[model samples]
Target: MIVCKFGGTSVADAAAISRVVEIITNKQSEQPVVIVSALGGATNLLLDIANKAAGGELLSALQLIEQLRDRHQREAQALLGGSTEAEELSLDISATFDELAHLAEAFRTLGYLTPRSLDAVAAIGELLSSQIVAAAFRHQGHPAVFVDARDVMRTNDFFTKAEPDTDEIRQLAQARLVPLVQQGKIPVMGGFVGATASRVTTTLGRGGSDYSASLIGAAIDATGIEIWTDVDGMLTADPRVIPAAQLIERISFDEAAELAAFGAKVLHPATIAPAVQRGIPVYVYNSRNPGGKGTMIAFDAPRLPVRAIAGKRATTMVKLRSSRMLLAPGFLRRVFEVFETHRTSVDVVTTSEVSVSVTLDDATNLASILQDLAAFGDVSVSPRAGLIAIVGAGISDGSLAIAQAIAALGPIPIHMASLSATGINFTLVIDDDQVIPAMQRLHATFFESAS
Candidate 1:
């Protein structure tokens, strides 16, 4: 069995969804469990409606509702024709919208928009799109079972960023999902939305549908999980920064995860953890051109010193120094404890006898972090920093890779650098504006010149 996940762009309209059906129909024999995201921009629109209503512009919010209703109705009609399936699905879509309209009214009356309320409103996109896609499949003469993901995915009531309970999830997926696939029918699920133990609606944060698919794939112990997005595959570098960026045909799971954690957008950083635990191969493919080889990620693959260059802009670096840290064993531990207390994640770190520097993307907890860190030493924070990470299984190939990476930066000042303990990644923090040029230079040195 294989888990096939389609992102929003792959199911944006009637034509896009039609292509999705074709892909599934071709792979039906593989016992595919289909996962779908919201139609393009639906989540944003739904969230906008909720925000507008909470701000007291119910009229404007309701206008967007009508537009949503029309858009889904048109797509469903186009995909399913005038069949009874299309009409029934149309009404189902409208009914879902009616709930949103009511939610908008409630927000207006309350004059507030809470995270819980926002999740309730935002999750409607996946709910509506999945139902439409399932109906379309049946119209095309395929047996499809629409499973409310909330029924199978159990999470804490964290509202916008609920974390899934794996034990509960595995039991539910086996009991609810396995049978349908065993009976030769496709299990269609809306990705990214789940319910708490008490059934309160919750979202898994942005770009979480990918996480949903990976979790489900692991639960079922499927042969593979395929993530279908706009890009052909993971590339040698960000294509926008390096137009000559070539598709990476294969990579190790650790390398892929490092790239994603640093800056790669094709896969969510959390998407592969569950699958990795289960030792399942995850594939990234393009729905537009399904014939492309895409990229395969697994435990073993061809090892290269520099498989990819990934970088994120708008990062911040924090530096700490003190004489007290000298010969202190727990100094690093205490510094990290401050990060943990504030719930901020440190992406890269390098340390000396009396000083430590770390990079962070989430500054939401910066103020609290700085206050706590000050107890240990002098603390300084630099904003608008960027990180460029070189990911590979061959990172321990001596100093050659590191030298090449720094040489590519040319005259750019490197604020800090570190090689991972596992030797899978080498990272550098620099000014935000220099990220593009740094990436271009690195790509040319490592990829372009090599070709």
Candidate 2:
């Protein structure tokens, strides 16, 4: 069995949904299990409505809901040809909007939007999209089963960002998914949405649809997982920055994860972990060019000298210095404790005998984190920092790669540098203004030959 996940763009309209139908029809022999995200930008619109409702703008929120209803209703009619099934599905979709309206009213009365309430409002996008796609698939004569993910993907009561209970998930899939596959039925489920054991609605965080697909693939022990999205595949550098950036044909799980974490848009950062642990291969394919052989991610890929160069701007660097840290035993530990206390994640760290520097992506809590770190020693926060990572299997062969990187960088001043202990990634810190140029230079130095 194979697991296939289509992103928002793949199912955004009737034409896109038809293309997905063709993809699934071609894979009928593989007994594919399908997962889908919200139709493009629907989740954002839903969130906007939720926020407006929380702010007591019920009329504006209801206007957005009406627009959403019309968009989906039009797509439903176009795809299903306005049959009775299409009419029934339209009512189902309207019911979800009704629920949203009711929730908005409740929030207006309550004068606040809790995380749990927000999740309840947010999950309707995936729910409605999945239902529409399933109906469209059946309309095309495929035996498609609309599996409400809430029934199979059991999670803790975290609401907004619930963590899945793997044991229960595995059990549920083995019992529920296996039979559906045996009957030669294609199971279509919603991504990024789940429910507690008691059936309370919840969601995984943003860009979490990819992670959702991976988790489901792991639970079912599928042969492989495919993520169909808008891009061609993973690229050597951000195309917006480097016009000549080349598509990466194959990458290892670790390399992909590192690139994603550093700002590769092809996949979610957490999407690779569960699949990597299960040794399942993931293919990133283009929904536009369904026939194109996109990037493949697997275990033990051939060692490339440098597979990709990825970077992220809008980062902050924190530098801590004190003579007291030189002989202090738990000084570094204490410094990190402050970040933990503030619920901020540290991306990179470099240290000397008496000084330490760390990079953080979450700048919202910077002030509080700086205050807490100041209690330990002198702390300085540098905003407008960026990080660039060179990812490949042979990144740590020697100091040769680092030397080449620094040479390629030329006069672009690097603020910090660190090589992963496993040697799969070499990261450099630079000013936000230099990130794009550095990525372009490094990509040319390493991947130009392949390009």
TM-score on alpha carbons, each prediction? 0.96, 0.95
lDDT, candidate 2, equals: 0.89
Clashing residue pairs, backbone N/CA/C < 3 A, model 2:
none
- CA lDDT scores, all candidates in order: 0.92, 0.89
Give the winner by lDDT: 1
Q: Residue 29 of candidate 1: its Cα lDDT?
A: 82
What is residue 399's positional error in candidate 2, in angstroms?
A: 2.4
- Per-residue lDDT tens digits of candidate 1, residues 1-451? 8999999999999999999999999998889999999999999999999999999999999999999999999999999888988878888988988988998999999999999999988889898888888988998889998999889889998888889998999999999999999999998999999999888889898888999999999999899999999889999888888899999998988999999999998999999899999999999999999999999999988988989999899998999999999998777888899888776789888888889999888898898898988999899999889999988888787889899889889899999888888798998999999999999999999889879
**Highest-scoring model, TM-score:** 1
Deviation (Å) of 65 in candidate 1: 2.5
